[model samples]
Target: MKAVVIEQFVSNFEDLKPRDAPLPSSKKSSDIQIKVTHASLTHVDMLYAQGLHQNNKRHVKPPFVLGTEFAGIVISSPSNKFAPGDRVFGGGLGSYAESICVDEGIVRRVPGLWSNAEACAVGVSGAVSYGSLISVARLKRGETVLVLGASGGLGVMAIQIAKAVGAKVIALVGDKEKSRIMKELGADEAVSYRQRNWEEEVRALTDDGEGVHVVYDAIGAIESALKCLRYRGRIVIVGFAARGGKMEEVRANRILLKSAMVHGYRYGEDGRRDPRRTEEVWSGFLNLVEAGGIRPIIFQGNYMGLESIPRAFGDLKMHKVWGRAVLRINEDVEATKEAARL
Candidate 1:
């Protein structure tokens, strides 16, 4: 099997190299074996390659697989929940190869409505968006919700999910183009934070300038997201997409004045600490997809073979790609269907 292996942390994507390795063996009873069809690159993957994420760098060592989300078909599994040739998608390790092994507990069946690429795109961003809105944020019907970084993968999903839950969504992006995309994804209003007066614009957009009921801050810049929140508003920090600087100063008096809540979420931590609850959330995400409440925005890129993993990581680092970047790993049944249609 061909895999992309990172021997050491390097700033350039060229540091990652493609190497041939033996195919992964399947577990006979306890684990499920998937013939990987597509694996999507994420911002966190770039950070992991750059040795930025503290947890990813600590747990994942060199000569390890890079991809975190994938969609494929079951080749073999002892669990009755899946069987030979069952289509499924979820998050796991070593997904940049032709096959991957995952525990039966974390994987879920992909909805028939989605393509292989769409399925591959859903697990990480979709789960985070839905979990943050429905689980962590506890968004209420008719409440106003703000989605920072609303054009990225998680942001796009958050826009749709917030609307699905009956919240009026105000999307914030870096540019007008992304703002347009956010509106297309179901945001009631899209604001670009690039403008100097954008925060004031956000204040004016909501009713009585009361601030939004919930702000999903995917961009980790603390001050921008915080400043936009209204009194009693809650901000859920999911990722730091922009301004990877040290945490800036936030006035405690502001928190006291608004009586707002600041919360941070790590999807992997939440999944590990409460596997059953995580599984439930994952199921809800799939249900949303099935019901057409959410859809994956796939930005098509070069369909490189296994050898191009390093360059793919490089593109990710340079922010050259948008939405989900999927690499096809194998000619599984679903992939075959997609290819035939194409």
Candidate 2:
């Protein structure tokens, strides 16, 4: 099988290459093998290739596949709950391959409403957005919520999820175009963070200029988002897309003054530690999708053969696209079979 293998730590994306590798072996009765139809790229994938993640420094040596999420058809199932042709969506490391073997505990059956592309894009972003707003943030109806970095995959989902939870959502983007996109995704108002006094604009849009009750900061621009929070508000740190490495310095007096709480969220860790909680969050997200309350935003990439994957990574780093960028693998696999056939 053809796969994108990270053979070395490359400073440039183009240095990564596609290589022919053996297909993964099927697991015993406790595991299942999926024919990967689509795999999507995230910033974390780039970081992993560059040896930025903690494990990459020690483990993740040469000749390892690199990817975290994919949607596919079941070729073989060891459990009674799944059949050979069942469509499923799930997440796993080293998914940039033709097939993957995963524990049945981590995979979820898609609900026949989404496409393989949508399912692949929704993996970590959808779960994190839904879980942070509905669970960690404990967002209340009629409350105001702010989504930082509202144009990215997780940010876009956060905007929609906050609205689905009955909160007045304020999406913070970097420019007017992204602001418009956020508004279309159900944000009550969108603010451009590039503009001066954007924090004041966020405050003005909420009730009585008191700021928002919950702030979802995926950009890691925590100081600005923190300053825009209301008294006794909660801030959910989803990711550090904007600022990486080293913690930001936040004043303790400010936390004391506002009586605010800061929470760090890592959906992957949570899912690995507590599978039931992960399933519950996924159920809620799918229910909202089925109810027409939220929709996945996808950015399509050209269908390239398995050998062209290194270029896809380059395109991602160049900011040549937006939303979720997916690669079609296994031309024999139907694009609709993974998510739409559920």
Candidate 3:
């Protein structure tokens, strides 16, 4: 099998290269063997490659697979949750190759309405958004939410999830184009942070400029978003897209005056802490996708094969990716269907 491997942490993404590797097989009866069709390269993947990821579940020191989330056809399943022909998608190791072995508990079935690429794109983003907003943040129905960096995968998921539960969403992005896309995703209003007085603009969008009930701060915009919160509103710090999550100072009086709640959320770490709850959230999110309640946006510009990892990584690091990016790990997902029919 051909797989993407990183021998050592390097400053350059081009340092990652494809190598002919031995095929992987399931070591446990509860494991799933999948023939991978598509995989997603997240911003976290970029951060991990650069050794910027601080709270990663695993250290990933060197000589490991370079990718995680994947959509694939099951080759074997020893549990009742899936069968050999089930089309599934989820996050796990060994997805940078044609075949992968993962614990059955981590993978989930793909919705009939979604393509394998879309399934691959949603695993991390959907898990993170739904987990942070619903499970961790406990956002209630009819609440107003401001989703920072609303154009990226996590941000887009946050917008859709907020809308599904009847919450009004004010989407924030770094540019006008993302703002447009956010509006198309059912955001009540979308604004670019680059625009002057954007935080005030966000406030003006609310009734009496009282700010939103909840601020889903995935871009680490803690300080500015503080001004965009209503009294006693909650803010969940979900992502660190700014400055590699460097510690920044915040006015204690702002949070004090508003009587707001501030919390940090990392989906993977949360899952590690509580697997059963994470599974339930993942299942519910896929159900939302099946019912036409949410749409996972994929980046058309960065959709490429495994051969394009370098280019895609470069684009991600430079903040050129506008939405979720996917890599088609295999060209023959339809071929898996043919086998299923037989």
Clash number for every model? 2, 0, 0
Model 3, residue 113: what's the lDDT? 78
Q: TM-scores, in order shown? A: 0.90, 0.91, 0.92
| Residues 1-342, model 2: lDDT tens digits | 777788777787777666778888755566889888888777777777887765576666666788888888889888698998777878777788888888877788766777777777776688898889888989988999998878777887888888887889998876676677778778899888878989999999988999899999987877887789999999999887655333578777888888999888888789879878888898888888889887878776784566566777777666555567777786457644534656
Better of 2 and 3 by lDDT: 3
Candidate 1: where are CA atoms >4 Å away? Answer: 26-29, 243-253, 310-320, 331-333, 337-342
Which candidate has the top score in TM-score?
3
Which tens-of-lDDT digit does each residue in 1-342 have in candidate 1?
677666676687766665786777765467888888888877767776676665554688775677778888888887688977778888877787778888877687877787777888766788888888888889999999888877777887888888888999998876667677777778889887768878778878888886788899887755666677887788898988654423457777777777888888888888889887787788887778778898888767776667676767666556555567777777456756456556
Q: Model 2 Cα displacement at 137 (Å)?
A: 0.7
User: lDDT per prediction?
Assistant: 0.77, 0.79, 0.81
Who wins the lDDT comparison?
A: 3
Candidate 3 local distance difference test against the native: 0.81
- What C-alpha lDDT, on a 0 to 100 scale, does residue 16 get in candidate 2? 62
lDDT of 2 at 75: 91
Ranking by TM-score: 3, 2, 1
